[model samples]
Target chain A: MLDAFGQPQSLVVLGGTSDIAGEVVRTLAQRRCRTVVLAGRDRDGLDRSADAARAAGAERVVTVVFDASDVGGAARAVDDCFDAAGSVDMVLLAVGMLSHQRDELDVERTREIVSTTYAWPAGALTRVAARMSEQGYGRIVVLSSVAAVRVRRANFVYASAKAGLDAFSIGLGEALRGSGVAVQIVRPGFVRSKMTAGLPDAPLATTPEAVARAIAAGLESGAPVVWVPGVLRWVFGVLRLVPQALWRRLPG
Target chain B: MPERTLLCGWGRTAPTRACVLAPEVADDVQRALAHADARGTVARGLGRSYGDAAQCAGGVVLDMRSLAGIGDVDQVTGEVDVGAGASLDSLVRATLPSGWFLPVTPGTRQVTVGGAIAADVHGKNHHVDGSFAQHVAGMTLATPTGLRRIGPSSDPELFWATAGGMGLTGVVTEARVQMLRVETDQMLVDTDRFVDLDGVMAAMEHGDADYRYSVAWVDCTAALGARRSGHTGRAVLTRARHAARDDLPPPDRHRAPSPPPSTWLRAPRRVPPHLLHTLSIAAFNEAWYRRAPRHRTTELQSMWRFFHPLDGVADWNHLYGPRGFLQYQFAVGPGEGAVVAAVISELADRRIPSFLAVLKRFGPSAPGPLSFPVPGWTLALDMPIGPPALRACLDGLDEAVAAAGGRVYLAKDARLRPELLDTMYPRIGELRTVRRRVDPEGVLRSDLSRRLGLDRGLDRGLDRGLDRVGD
Candidate 1:
């Protein structure tokens, strides 16, 4: 169960291989989170994250195979993960594939990015929300991006997919208001991780650890949406109002 | 299916949704218990608990107020059978006119009889009369298995467990309580003002035994703006005894015992959020402390004025505003009064403003494993819930409290961590054993029980087993 501080004692990380997700698991483990269920596609990466959690004071660590490419299998994978660890107090959704930057949209690349960033995640989250509502109490933290606030010209496909995910998460939270289940969305500007290894750093770029801290704070405060560095909350407020003519000229 | 209702404790924090069913009869309670799902069912009364003790998320909450009925008081024995839903206000009104009063009334007379027993509430006179359960002779409890009439002699384990068990034992349908006989509705109260924590502590230790009721109001905000002496625990102490018929003024000598008075004022339903910050609370504290007479003896005051001062202001908790407040009350053993002092100093140093801080000396604890009070000092403070430092500050205090062999009162607690539950209540295993006996299927649970991990021993043990596997 989550304590009054909103710290969960047991949690499931859907994208366990994601750097931000791994850091969150380790941080929570140190904060007394005992049981960890890490589900991702990479076998070796899942093992590494599980070991990190175990060393960080998690008493029980379980790993499950989950493939974002197989959107149809999302619900089944989530069920297996929850069944492997009964009575989970929290679930962190942190799966995404940053498509290679290109001037012209490739039909297949757009499809892959949308599937990984939006469709599969939304499917898995819907299943998790249903299970959590039945359990009577749980917290769901989804790692979105500042790009979701307003899709950029350079990475429109990835940003637009995130925009869809961000909307879905907010809507789901409102739907589960009285179910003793809460959903929190984390929007980080530019996080340094494996997925963005070679990308040019965006303004207000942050690290995985910083994003983890923001998630912890957001969960504690029961905030519906949290922005990394916090300033981005205002930064995006202004960015969203910029005229289309001016926005198009801004560099990525 | 009944529509879910959002419920919060008196402090109005951590609200949860539950299917609240008003049970008019014992049969209704039994039916609800039998039909309870895995999320579980618990009983609720006037909801005076400061936290989640009465709330069960996504489960059934049997509203026992429908069964409220006060039986005739035994003229000679002073024992009255009361339905769990009956409020102390109603009980006092029924019996006080006949020269009898509730033996243990909390600061508010609004709590139901079941809530009083479930929380085993104590009042200014706890040092003399013990908690509410001490005065209860017997009660009928509705469990998932069946209904049972239990007392100190018949099913002593269940009886004691039901007391201060936070309703996890079962839903108390009715109880026979032993009220105290009094001469009048007035009290002869003595008031004293102290400039430091040590002065009041010494006074209470030596003088509390001489009075039937005693309590001290410490100015926590005063501690923040410490005087040159660096004394942070300035306080106003009041001790009282029932005013005999002859003690009253000439014209009122022949007056009959009256019921406790009703509220004279009510806080508005809505107020601006974060209205009671440090500046405002500090000013209020200063005015309150200065208003009390330095030393006054045998001042005749009404029962309501003397015992339930806050009750005179209806919904006074609303003054804390939309975000609500947290009442942190904890008790420590004798010779550990320094822990109380340390906590006051810590709050002062951290600049965390507390509006009302009450200090009292407690008598020996009751038999209930989870009963909060012991033979020692207990302090309760009310703080609005917004400070970023508040959580960690209170966490540090919890560690101090556990180390000092003390425990936070579950009824008023909203944020106590689970790891220290054993250290705080060593006999919790006994509670779990009795609970497993009465509710083996775990059909009885509350948000407090779940948050504190009070109802999941087997699951916790399984985690320990997994720990072994990992090793």
Candidate 2:
């Protein structure tokens, strides 16, 4: 359902999805969404995801193959998805990787870590965010982390990476303001998913299913920030103000 | 700002605003009741009720006055459909043409049909007709469960509950009230006044059964030695149901008085903060003796002019000025009446002069949970408004009344403390149970409710238990 301008008017996410994007899709669906373009890198994963989404009751789902690390073509890739569908209603920036913590101590490895986890995704999403702003009716959802609140000695590199991304998401949302384009930032704590398999459970860690619910609820509630395992907002609030000596002694 | 609804009782005097709904027809009453039942609102009548009985504190009072229609009068059966808010004056006028009258009239005709039913008011005729509830043929009450047309035949428990149920049972919109066929608008004459207080009681007790109407007029301003004009007047409408049809008068027709001189109004005395004291009261008593009458009764009086003389005064309360007077009307329950009477006499002996004294005999009490009447003697006395010292005197009366197992009238009270009220009426919790069932959403309320915390909405027995513990 492409317009004469050949831009997507709506979008959807199939299986390889971000929690916040799934929520934004559900919100639009409730409001009677008509056309949607589903974009992801894996065609098979997208098709499989589409089947589940159609079952969960999305009216439409389409897939676009792309590599987010290829920043030069990222903006063009977004336009193609809209050209294939009708127009873009939402662009969910849920692509990221949690680099190996021990590998980050190596300077050369840290550059790779920063590129995969931050630089490319940041640059690519900014281009997509601007495209949506030009469309004049768009929603950009960015996945953030609670660790972005403060960088600790143990996870400072990961925390710092998230901190930069969080600031980018917030600043991007503000830039889109008055353009009729809105941004939603989701901040989830340690969430259990296939990506986090084989790792010990973190205190206040939440499951993917829990994160999904929080995402959808946040979109419906129009919240600026979200914390999974909901009470952690308060839990982390207390953690931030405690005397440093007392805080360091408390095991996570 | 959004406002919450509250409930008002007959004894409370505070004013509050909630949405007001006055149902006009049965169907309207039903719809309002259903809506309030589904949601909730307090159904109230002519805010004439003394306390919160007609108000729902923060809630709207469903002003029942809109249901003021007096249905077709049954000249044959002496029955009439009275809209809940119809005043007794209107009902009497509408029905008297057919030679019928209210089975019982309270001290005032200004009371609405619904208010009378709620209070189950009685007059000098209580010894004969019992409370007003006894003569109610049927009533239409709007409850949480739609409209229930009830009477002795339909849902007897609820019927009894609605009779003297105060407004808690539901909004009683229209009632098939039984009217008595009267020989005339005028009552058969008889009057005998006593010189002393005991003579009045002795006369009422010895021969009250002989008269359908009996009452006493006391010179409250009489001196200690001579003012206790223990004088009681008694009368009965002659059973000879023969009225010269040619002279048939309207219901409101009654004898008029020679207007008292403006100076006759003692209210101008300003009731100084200390005027109600022992010596002042004694002095007033001495002056009352100067205007003497040992015993006497004027004959052939119109029933309204006799029972409800206040109806003629327009705004009689204005006579008491901005400081509105408090009428302490209490009756002893069974053996308690004697103690109350003794207390009243003692107050006079102590020089606390009551401007008016009305004594009557109550029949077997109504089983309504919070019905005020008991099987004993009752007295209604009025006192001019004054300062704190006078309040202390009333508090003393309250203690004695509560001690004697008696309660004051809620509709006539303005300053009674809650402790004595609870002591007098122990069935408040029981009444609240029915109130909640009738209006689950907690809507019906009035100003009086806020004063005494009647519709407090919380059932924390710890407070009650604590009060008992403190006692």
Candidate 3:
């Protein structure tokens, strides 16, 4: 249950080790959020995130083993997370993979990227939404990317996965309307996180904290969609109208 | 489960969305409190607090109205155990037929028992009977931990904290209140018109003790003209007391009339945005002042007319329009009555249009730390949120009030600066200590608490935790 000030008492993060997810939990903990459930595969990374959440003010930090790429086990994993943490006020789905452009055509890499970025998340989130609808109140935050607006050749594989997830999340929000469940889609142009460390800086690049703040505010204000830099929504609106030749010619 | 909806106080300003849940029983309240998310939960009752005290943005709002049940009244003692969600109107209807009335009631009977306690609301009879909490013998508070029955004698600290605690301490489930015995449902009101502020103040200071209820409706607009001639603060003073059985007509003297159910006049759901502008309000005030007799004594008036005239016009707040209005009410100690005069003059000088300002003399302050009244004078005025300088002017008045050892009523405050909170309420730290004991995790929170920095200690705890992790 979110309080009158929009502070949640407990939060369950599916990709708990993600930089953006950790930042969101830390911010909420600072505002007196007492319970945090971190679900991820990396033990050491999960420990670090749990420690940060406790330091940020969470009274209890529960870490659960989760593998987002285990598409067949997604439903069980989500159910386990909720079973461990009763009545979650918010569930953040911040899982994705950035396969190299050269590996885009490789069958195995393509299958892995699509499975990790979209297939497993969609499977798990569907289960999460069902549980939320049963309880009649919950917020699900899906981290998409600006790449989904118009898939450039440089990151078409990752963009396509995000495009599928983004559309699914929006439609899911509509499906859950009046059921007391909400799905917030967060799109960032380029976030300065460990995932994008080696990539060249993109225009309107933001930090994990910035993305976390935007997500927190969006949930507080009950906004359906939030853009990290905010201006990306307008930027993408114009990019979508550009001629195909001009858009394709643009450098990465 | 919580449903998202926009809620505003009686003043109708700064509407915010909250996930509202109506809990039917004490257990429901406990479950809701246990699950309330980070934003925190605050209990709401009748929404009569004039400001955001009852509203919690983005958080769960426990609508206690579902807890409505009036228990058997103690015939010998005039004591009753009433649900916190039960409105004074309902209680009055039930108890009045048994020859009893509320110990203290504000200008309206629509307020809930929980709201009355949360505000420690003062009625026109404050000089005689104190506030609503003074007569409350015991109560059941559903805190984040669990439900606990407390009273003034048992755990006085928690009891006083919950009283005027603004529903921050916990959600009041039920209260054992002592009702006042009355002979009739009518009042023998004495109406007097004063030509200047000093005249009315002098009359109240000298003769108010003679009556159980007294209030003055000052014409702020009329004072503007009087200010130039060195005379100001013209008002219409009405003082009254419960009429005795023999005071009524000979035919009706044997029995008290049953109080009327409040279906008098219904205000339109939506009025023009600027219906109560300067010209219109001024005209209304002028006519209202002139309409009262120069001096009338022992005039027989119904309980509805004397105590809650505004209740007749349901949804009167909508008349202020879409922009809404702010009810700026402040209290100053004895010898600081000039502060009231200065505020009225200032509002008039700024060309700020205010409806009839209510001026009342407070007898003494309650033991509750956050209670708004004190031994002196209090004035409440309604001004539209149109003037560009309205915010600045009110801010200035806040400083002046604080400097004079006065405080703005939190129940009616929407814009008081957080920095001035401690100065206005010196005992806030003590209240915080008591609050933490009841709500250790800070599960109970509201928009007003966030706005006034009452939740600072919760954040401070986070900083402390971070320090420990660093060590």
Candidate 4:
């Protein structure tokens, strides 16, 4: 269970191999989170992340194979994680793909991006939520992006998928009200992690360590939505008001 | 009119918004229930319950403070019909002057009679007198169905269910209680300072029956204090009995037995930042342990000073800061004393400071299925909630307590899991049955009931998630 300060004793990371997720787990483990469950498709990456959690002072670490693109198996994979851990106090949903700018007509790639970022995570989160509701309390932290504020011409596929996740998370928080379950949406501008290592840094770009710190603070405050740079909340507020023609004309 | 209000238990955690209605009379209680929306209603007193037992979120909370009155005491029968809203403080003041005292008084006098019965609160004298409900002669209950007068003899099932029922049975409007007769408003207390947990446990087990009231204050920080000096788990044990008038010192022989004083001091209204911590609490514990006399017998002390010392400071809960504290209280049977020792050791070893750790011996429990006390020892620990290690520590203790056939006090609980409720209290099924009979539509619900999933049917799943997060 999450303490009054919003630090969970045991947490599960859906995309355990993600750089941001690994950083968050290590940070929380140092804060006395004793149990960590890392689920991802890469066995070697999951092993490495689990070792990091152990070295960071987690008393127990469990890893399960999870392929987010396998939407049909998403719920089962989630159940396996929850079953292995028993009662889960928090879950970090960090599964997403940052595909490069591509033709809209590349239907196969679009399907995979959408399913990995939106459909699979949404299905798994719904199952995780049900388990938590039955347990009577839990916390869920969903990683989103500033790109979700408005889908630009570049990387619209990835951005639109994050937008769907952002909306779902907000609604989930409202739905769990008074039920002792909470959902937090974390929107980072641009994180210099494995996913974006080769990409050009966006304005107010941050490191995985910085995003992890923001997530820790957000969890402590039980904030519904967290912006990594803090300034981006207002940045997005104004950006959301930009006219479509002007937004399209602006360079990436 | 019902007004939206945020309410929490005495520990001051898990605050939830609810529509509150102060019901001055019995009819008002009925009206509030009738007008209650989809969210049900529950009665609240001074809200001394440590958790959400009295708080129904997004629902109606019938504030019973207005149902206030004290009937004329029946001096011959030693019985009094007191309003549910009448606090033990007021009742103590009124009756102590008449040489009649409550049979059982918890650590605080601020608790309302309704709350006392609802939680079936036990005092240091529980080993002899049982809980508050054991002394209840009869009670008037306002349920969703209608008003019903019940008592242990007349309706044992509902009467016992209502005791420690956490207000789910009904809103107890009035109760006739049998008070104990005392010679004076003073206590003849014996204080013994023990060097460790075993010394105190042995003394209490052998000697508690000789005294009417017994309690021990354990200095949990002494595990660290011991390494500095050589006293491990030091504690101060006090056992007391009502003093006869002749026992008083000659200086005040002519004075009449006085009422207990109201709050003489108040805690800070706003939380002071990091006011309590391991170092500060260790210092306090060391001082407290040293302050007690090595051995003192027949010391004359005011009843309130002996029983409700914390009452001297009002709003003391604020000292824990804005996050408040968690009061984890659990009881284990005779052979389970090892669990008690283990729990204290765990806290001491972990350096998790508990400002107040009370140890008491309990007699046979009352008939209430949910009554916390059983036939052995119980400990109550008050710890501030911010420590990252606190939750896992408590969760581990919960398993230990349950494994030893012990159960945590629901009144003092906020985070107990649902799966272990059955293991701890097998008779809880009986409580569910009684609640169903009285409130079939589930008109009474609280955050506690919802969290424990108490109102739901039996056949509870035992598949609990890993509650214990170790080192």
Alpha carbon lDDT of each predicted model: 0.87, 0.60, 0.84, 0.85
Off by over 4 Å in 3: A1-252, B222-232, B460-471
- The DockQ assigned to candidate 2 is 0.01
Q: Which candidate has the top score in DockQ? A: 1
TM-score of 3: 0.67
Question: How accurate locally is residue B14 in candidate 1, as Cα lDDT from 0 to 100?
Answer: 68
TM-score of chain B of each: 0.96, 0.78, 0.96, 0.95
RMSD of 3: 9.1
Give the per-residue lDDT of model 2 (tens digit) for B409-429: 766665566545568888777
Model 3 interface CAPRI class: incorrect
Candidate 2 chain B weakest lDDT stretch, 10 residues? B462-471
Output the number of the lDDT-best candidate: 1
The 10 consecutive residues of candidate 4 chain A with the worst lDDT sum are A1-10
B177-240 per-residue lDDT for model 1 (tens digits):
9999998989999999999889999999999999999999998874445533464689999999
As a whole number from 0 to 100, the lDDT of residue B442 in candidate 2 is 50
**Which 10 consecutive residues of model 2 chain A have the lowest summed lDDT?**
A1-10
Model 4 CA lDDT for position B429 = 88
DockQ of each: 0.36, 0.01, 0.03, 0.12
Query: CA shift at B420, candidate 4, in angstroms?
Result: 0.5
Better of 2 and 3 by TM-score: 3
- lDDT (tens digit, per residue) of candidate 3 on B120-173: 999898877788999999999999888999999998999998888899889999
DockQ of 4: 0.12
